[model samples]
Target: MQPGKILVAEQDGAFVIKLVGEVRLTLCTTMDDFFDDMLTSKGFASVVIDLVDATNIDSTTLGLLAKLAIKAKQRFSYVPVILSTNPDITRVLDSMGFDRVFCIRQEPVVDDEDLNELPVLPDSEDAVRAKVLEAHRVLMGMNDSNRAKFRELVTLLEGQCY
Candidate 1:
């Protein structure tokens, strides 16, 4: 298996962290260290996690994400954002009640410098809701078979999340 890796990038005053290869206990301390260092730095208005390239992720890694979300909220005054193509991670987030915390993205944030500018709030609450709805629409557009698979994944994950 490929060694686990996490790369941090930023743009528009937002932070994007891309997780690659296998994610297991090996990266836990590294993740913790990264977040700890960011605590006193110029904080980003939003933090996005890109997980499309992750080959596999274990429970320790998920806990690491959850901790980062909480720490991000406390230190930066905003909850973390996440982009995950792995249905297992998404389901874990939902089952752990992190849906109320992080903003899930359909696509990974594209810019490498999302930290240069501040996060922009949508002009209206309706606009924000619209964005969320659009994202759900895209997520739902996956093949029915894959959607069903994700559903089973959700069920399996819920039982494991603690």
Candidate 2:
């Protein structure tokens, strides 16, 4: 499968992220960097995640989305919205406890025509590892099921930390 791409844009104090194709581990660093920059910027008010074109998304990507929701609420006092038209993807999101942090809508996102693809940043081994570990940790915090599912991998990643 082809790697996923993230398209991003800012509109009237809100940021939008559109995920396309297969979203997996390789996009974690880029997502993490974008999250950092978006969350830190002044006057940032809200965020929307458009998953209409996403064919598949992995656990790491789910974790990063979770992180986005959590941070958005904590930092900006707004719950991030996730627009997904695919039932399968919506099912996956529901199963992963996304409803707790995001406003999951079974509809298309608005004003997506102006978004531009975020360039995939070159990855460093340490940066990728850190992003992966952080994403999984955020996932584990969602519920007991997630914690149980990711505990071993978290331990393994922790061990690899120097």
Q: TM-score for every candidate vs. truth? A: 0.61, 0.94
Error of 1 at 133 (Å): 37
Candidate 1 accuracy as lDDT: 0.59
Which stretches of model 2 miss by more than 4 angstroms? none
How many collisions per candidate?
13, 0
Model 2: per-residue lDDT, tens digit, 1-162? Answer: 767999999976788899999998898988888998999998898888999999999988999999988998887778999999999999989988999999999889756789999988889888788888988999999998899999999999988876
**How high is the lDDT of residue 105 in model 1?**
70
Q: What local lDDT score does residue 57 receive in model 2, on the 0 to 100 scale?
A: 94
Model 1 worst lDDT run, 10 consecutive residues:
113-122
Among these predicted structures, which one has the highest lDDT?
2
Using TM-score as the measure, the top candidate is: 2
